[model samples]
Target: MRIALATATGAAVLAAGAAITTVTPAYAAAAIADIKIDTTVSFIPPSGSDSIPFTVKVNSPYTGSKAPDIKAEFWKEGEATTSAGHAASVTALSDLANTTPAPTPASSVEVKGSIPVSSSDKPTTSTGKWTLKVSAYPDGSTTAVSSDTATFEVKAATRVTSANVDPDPVYLKSGKEVDVYAGFHLEKFGDEKITDVRLESKDSDDYYSLSTGLEADDSYHDSTSMDYSTSTGSWQLRISISRATKKYSFTKAFQVKKSGSSKAKSKITLYASPSKVKKGKATKLYGKVYRGSKAWSKKILKLYFKKKGTSKWKFVGYVGATSTGKYTKSVKPKYDGYWRTTAAATSLTSGSLSNIKFVDVK
Candidate 1:
């Protein structure tokens, strides 16, 4: 009786040990061996709809009856490490599941999923770094077996939407100054600040350049003066704007026309009193300006002088005419010379030169 009892107890003990061994494989941890993101997706814009695709290699200890779940989570650089703000889930490849309780290599498969980013996810700052983690989980389990992480960048997008130059057809007259204006509008996705805004002529010889910053309405405006020296012909204005590391440029054509023919004719008369004077003696230089047949009052005249035998004329000074159209100035003559005056061109009147006067210094 003792021998039979011992044999039955031994058999029961062996049966229990076998059952425990059989249940061990059911709870083995699944694992994610590696994850690789598509190299083409180097960066994500701060404000837009984007899909990040990747591949995950997984080792599943579970039976072929069910497949493990693969999950991807995204975290910004400064976010807390405890949890991620975005996540995507996908099923592991069917072939990854183990058919038997034997050791097997990890299987690589493209995860048919995407981490969607929307405009609301835009960062307040110009740019930032982001991290992605991929993990594998067994069926109906809350714990992750293993995970792998990768990194990428988030940057703002900038562009210039519209631009224009006021007074498309610039009208220029001899010795007259004209005002020209330029304006621009810009659009941006993130908080990046505009670094520069400038306007320049395509031809360096045109000599027009201006710069300004964006206003509260995201607009830029500036003005420059054009005079007789400015060339009249087909011209181009190149507009450039910069934000962060990006630069945008645009070119626009414009016309500059000479309108001197439409201006009224002008005339000036000049004379030096005491035609013959001792050296270093004071002499009176006087002039009168006229527009057409009428007196040009409150006008400015430029005085010039040159030695009798010299051809180069030296600028003496400026003289303003009175309400009666007469101007005068006292000068001491040191040598025999010729003197003259000129009236600069105006929007309504053409330029004119006066008759020369000779001063003989003894």
Candidate 2:
């Protein structure tokens, strides 16, 4: 009986050792779910408008039976600008919905939809490239840990033909308001929506206002209006839009006469033409006044352009003012990016920026 008991005890110990050898160490926290955006461009015939048919691809390397849900979004590159750490002229194209998970590995999954073409989405600068971002969310978790991005270009349907701003010389007194008019036209190239009209001027003051659903009056094609009361003699008025995909713009100027009881006097009005510019090309800008069309003296007006992320402002040479109340300047860009410019006045008060505009460089 003692021998039998000894053999049984030995067998039990061997069994325990085998069990320990068979077990494995826990996998380092299932590598946060991974995902990617896969897309291809297809053109609608005759129209030749570029459209994206995109799908989200997910990978679950872990041994788990179920996968997590993923979310996604799309953004245009180089749409916003900044000067001295302040934000200006930020814009977007589209926001897409999150996709459900696929049931099997290596099986293709996609969000059911198409990116639309519009009049506003026409590429004005930098080949109009945009990026699509996709992110994954694990089930029952608020934290989204996994993400990926895809890059593509938006083709131009129409290029900006001409842009001008008005009132040769816009004269105003300090604390007095004036309406600056810009005339522009759009060439129907793509099918994107161009929206959200605005005028912005900033210099460490953080002052900005947005006007929605406003377009250049029907009477004037390719134009919009804004109200500005000059706080200082020299200031910049930036004209911007809400949506800019396939959107090209040109401007012509119109002035608001000055009113009395204003704190100061503005002898001239200066501003950017086409408000937006395409990178690497020379864009024409005009400065005008209301000194009764006698035109400001032919002095070279100093101007500068700066991108959103950097601290430096590039000096765009002095623009000569026309005797007919207009100052004309040409801007050539060194990089494919988004930028805004400010024009300083010599003896102006009520008028700073007669207007603003935008162009896509890439």
Candidate 3:
């Protein structure tokens, strides 16, 4: 079959009997009539100087014995005829499977190359879409026999998303002194630097914690010592974060209760009847549950035991406090170990815990 070359049109004519087909896995079958071109990233950030890789696969099915030479060029969309607008240089591949740029190879073909990006291609400067044209030509001809064009968008520079806010509660009762921590997560996208990050106080409740810059992890965090006010109610903790192009406000409502308002103590204490005991002997454990000065009755308590040198505590048994606020549990010793107990929390009272007691096993 004799194929005609449209020298004047700059397009190589494909023989009717043999045609080049482009296979796009995602799209319907369409014949390119000669060559196929694909890319890794179709969207380039206008403000980014990142390189985009392209793969040009040419099916060597032609009447002539000479395999086609591939030419890869880049230009603004709709300007395929304007050769001066092209940005990539053709590099000959040492092997047929290679995909990067290099000088024309003497006997092989390379199809992979990257769209060059530099200071001039800064995202803000070019927000329009561009296209890459891959054309196949006979060894000595300038006319393209089969060609394919891949389009990509140069997107506007995108800023980081929103900043997230979080509060770490210290759970201090009124009249108790403690510290509270809050975090503002800053966002940094691409090569975009977080020029400035500041946590502005939105309310007095959040004034205790303040941050003006990024942490080691590019996050903003603040810690302040505070205590519950003299009442039982809710207060708003508000904070705002400011960045290059966006500001986000976050608020959280936390409850503050007067000291002694709840039956729970700042910390619970654990006690055992015998500090030392014989192996296989049962040791009794007890702890007083008090809400302020009043005994909190019938509270379920979990018992924990651990060996002196071990790092973890094992659950041994559970018991309930009596109406007089006293709780007791008896455990047979399997070995020498330390013992402790924790009172489960209730709606009206905070949980209590007993001190660790070591029992010597004989």
Q: Rate the local accuracy (lDDT) of all candidates.
A: 0.65, 0.41, 0.53
**Once superposed on the true structure, which residue ranges of model 1 sit more than 4 Å away at CA?**
1-28, 39-42, 60-62, 89-106, 124-126, 161-362
Give the per-residue lDDT of model 2 (tens digit) for 190-304: 4434353333222113223333232443222323333344322222333332223323222233323344533243355544555555666676666565422333334345566
Number of backbone-clashing residue pairs for each candidate, in the order shown: 0, 59, 14
lDDT of 1: 0.65
TM-score of 2: 0.26
Q: Using alpha carbons, what is the TM-score of model 3?
A: 0.31
Identify the candidate with maximal lDDT. 1
Error of 1 at 138 (Å): 0.8
lDDT of 1 by residue, 1-362 (tens): 00111122223323423422112224445556556655344234334566656666655434544566777788865786477557765554454435567545444344655666554555556565777777767677786655667676665445455667778777876778989887777665544455444334332234576775678988778888888656554466665644444345556677665675556568898888888899878999987887655567678899999998999999999999986678998899888999999999865468999999999999
Better of 1 and 2 by TM-score: 1
Encode model 3's per-residue lDDT on 14-126: one tens digit a residue: 56655544332211111123223333233343343655566655443232234456667777545555566565755443223334553343332336667765424534343
Which regions of candidate 3 are displaced past 4 Å? 1-48, 61-65, 77-83, 89-110, 122-127, 157-362
Error of 2 at 2 (Å): 75
